[model samples]
Target: MFSKSKCFVGGQIWSQTTRRITKWLKEVKSSTIRETQLQPTCSSPVYCYGPLLHTVQTAEPKLFKDSKTFVDMRMIHSQSETLDTFNKLMEKTEGKPSHEELKQFVNKNFESGNELENATLSDWKENPKFLEKIKDPVLRQFASDLNQIWPGLARQIRPHVIENPTQYSIEPVPNKFVVPGGRFMEPYYWDSYWIISGLLICEMPDTARGVIENFLWFVEKYGFVPNGGRVYYAERSQPPLLASMVDLYIKYTNDTKWLKDNIDTLEKELKYWLNVHTVDVNGNTLLRYYAPSAGPRPESYREDLETAKGNQALYTELKSGAESGWDFSSRWFADTDGSLNSIQVTNIVPVDLNAFYCGAVEHISNFYSILGNDKKSAEWKNIRDEFRESIYKVLWSEEDGIWFDVNITTGEKRKQFYPSNVSPLWTKCIGQNQNMVEVGDRVAKYVSQSDMFYYPGGIPTSSNRAGEQWDFPNAWPPLQGIMVEGLANSESQMAQQLSFNLTERWVRSNLRGFRDTNEMFEKYDCEVPGRYGGGGEYVVQSGFGWTNGVILEMLNAHGDELTADED
Candidate 1:
């Protein structure tokens, strides 16, 4: 009664099932299908009634002896039924796969998994516990929204209790904490440090500690943490934030023993910077930190010969004095003296690095004092004070009203307009007079300017539209967030306005970008208003740890006033 085509399809299904059974029988040589108990309620229903019934209802025991026949027949019928249903669906859709429609179907079935639906901002706001932990409603709202964007970010950021743990070290891949970005981000060691601040603010101390421990593990294992754990990532690291991360960890844990236990390792890291990374020429220590002399290239090593081809020139070349793998290394070359030298010259001395190093020395001194190592503490203090003096004298440019990095040997100030100049303010190293005011004014000007630093969303990395702008037009949440705090410290009214303007722009841009594309990109091309750029390899969304974390914390720090919060 069936049509020729139906018979042909059924015959094909039967043949396929027969072949499968034959293969199975060959594999299970002596064993019968009966030995392998098949469930009655299999995936398909047609198997119960079709060819299987015929094979099982046979009178001869020999026919029943090889249960493989029954099993194969059942599989044939089940497959045919499935094929028929698929064919019917295809007919209805005119042979289209219906991928989108199917996705909708699956999503509907798993509607509960939707982040916004599950953890609505309204729900977070209503939670008294969350409100108590994060007193600011704006911050709470921001966190709730971020949760909607990336659900596990907040939980992954919280600090946890480590009991009976291994030595205080960094694990490339922690059993408990997995950075959402994964192993691909091995080269971004210092970047992770900046991202950790957001986690700390979220009360995710465990996650923060785990990240620190992992870095320490890296330091203990490899002398310095490379840009990443992969072999290819061994060459370069991002900006060094080891000391800052240590400070944060100490603040949260208050574990003096942890500091004491790791002080030797920390000191070793510092020594590595001094002896290996920095070069001593004419009694002055010149920093040689970064390598390959190219700006923001994906590959850690230098791709070209002529040292800093483009925007990469904006960064300094610290040849010898990197304390951590994340510290900069100098480009390799032969000096005019015909001697192999690691060139420590950088795009600038970088206000941030100097400030961070100063802070590190101070922390080291404090730790030593606490440990009753007065001699060591005093030694470190003297070094710290000297570095502070150098930072002020060498990096400050009175003409520009901004503190810039100087080629320590040449004594020429790096004439670059970058956010790094704002970092010294964070360290409170800028003295009185109009120094703070001048720096604040410059930052304010950059914020208000439309063609350069100012964009629809936030401050850009660099202003030269033609030049490579790492921070230009692309408002990095971490930098913006830090500046907000730094501005508060300076108590500059203009700085406050700049911070508020940038924050509001970011929120607006984020909303607009998300609306257009249902994800938060790594960096937004603020110049274009809604476009996102600068993502390499990965599908640059989802695991935006720093952006989500920093923004939430910054908003919280600002409290009800998203602009001017002294605290």
Candidate 2:
């Protein structure tokens, strides 16, 4: 009876091995892992009993573990010899394979198996080896989904694809630039700034620099950094931050000459946004910037106005108010502008854009001073001050306790409470007394209240249960970081509390998910704790760069200031 049982188990192992090897060989091309002429001896039961029984006995877990230890020890002894062989091959190949060759090699070597197909939950629990192999595959699929929905998330969150020097040569894809969320993100200029902050936290200064240089290169090659570099990316220009990035790069590398060379390109980008994109309305001459009529679609509330044609009309109308330097025509569209013609209407002034322009001017002035252009420095300072004064005079709402976007055509405030109203405080462009206190109070109120802007993760980009929820329950890392830094600058007690709250929430969220399943998700659903917010409508990403970067920076700043002393 014992002999019969051993033969039964042996037959099972042999059949499994034969099926696995056949399937693997069939899938691979003839060029790789050629099949040997040797065949299994199924005809002779005696031969099967001899080797197969011995194989099953030796493959027992206890014996296999000991065998593996011996094999590993042997490998350690031959490590030097193996390394030498590898080095010789590398030497013979003259360093690295070409891009095409590397791609072919990867294609040949990488194989996806059917281990995950129709895999049941119980299967994962029972099969440790199968579960282990599918872990990375599952993550990769999630990442693919993230990249498709939120392209920016991919760029900001995905792990850096590293090329081994010996195996592959890295090359840029033609007519391509790194998109924020994913592989083919619709390029946006300001978005990269936040993305860079995350990169900095990863101690990836080189990658951070490459991302910055890509923007600078775009500015040099195209005269202006279009909302993004691609044709589809021409919707709106974001706040100019090339000078700030240059400053940041200098901070990391102390490469003054690099700053010097890029200074000209930076200056041009500044001028393009400040002079060309902005307009002077009613003799105020305050700095005004334009947002492409195309706003973020997935984030916006109204589905009807999210179309390209609708946004185009909005853009055309906005251009007409180019003279006012303050356009608010687009603000009311989602609220009350019922006509499709209303989509073309522009003249709406955006508070965040103006505030960002203030920051750009301040950075440019600082850059000029660094370059010893004192005269230009003074000029920029004067311009900055004038812009600041106009912002206070025209945009401030004493009753609302916040700044607002004004209608350039109508010359009235939009009366909508949004986060952009408080964003200017981060720029330090507002006054110290009443305006600061009021803005601080508003920010504190929004952050502390759970049903409003506050969420489990962090302060939402816009407020929930408000007129518009742009700042509601969704927390973006860049915005959250800026707000934390801004509040700290103002010395608001709320800043510390909010920072701690956000940091703890993020850390806990990551730990819970990773500890439970050994996986990291993209974004926590701010409205619903413990659930993943469906990624932006592009791709599901992993290692979300900005999220990881911001979390690190925020945690680092938990008991300290968010910005350097220079601010």
Error of 2 at 542 (Å): 5.2
Error of 1 at 25 (Å): 77
Query: Which segments of candidate 1 are over 4 A away from where they belong?
Result: 1-139, 147-187, 279-286, 292-348, 407-410, 431-453, 467-471, 515-518, 528-530, 535-542, 563-567
Indicate the worst ten consecutive residues by lDDT in candidate 2.
Answer: 114-123
Question: What local lDDT does model 2 show for residue 347?
Answer: 50
Predicted candidate 1 versus true structure: per-residue lDDT over 1-567, tens digit per residue? 111221122112211122211221121111112312322211222222232232222323323333222222212123444445545655776755355543332233222111111111222222323334555554555456665443343222112113211111112233233233422222246556656665555555665666677666666765655554332233344455677777777886787888888887676555444433343222333344544321222221122112334322222232112312212221111121221123343322456666666667778778788788987787667656655665666666766666665654466665655556677676666543346666677656554553644667666654433322243445555666666666666666887776666666666566566657755555667677556745222233445766665666555555455432225
Per-model TM-score versus the true fold: 0.60, 0.57
- Shift in Å, residue 374, candidate 2: 1.1
Can you write out model 2's per-residue Cα lDDT over 1-567, one digit (the tens) per residue? 001111122112211121211221122111111113212211211111132222222332322222212111111113234345434544655745444443333234322221111111111111212122222343323223222222233233111212211111111112223344333233356656655654443344565666777777677655666554432223335566666666666766776677777777777776565434444444454444443332222111122233334344343444323212112223335343343235322354567667777777777788778778887687667657766766776687776656777766567777664545666777777743445555676666654653544565555544332222222344455555666666665556665566455555654454444445443444445665444444222233444544544554554444232221112
- Clashes (backbone N, CA, C under 3 Å), per candidate, total 50, 45
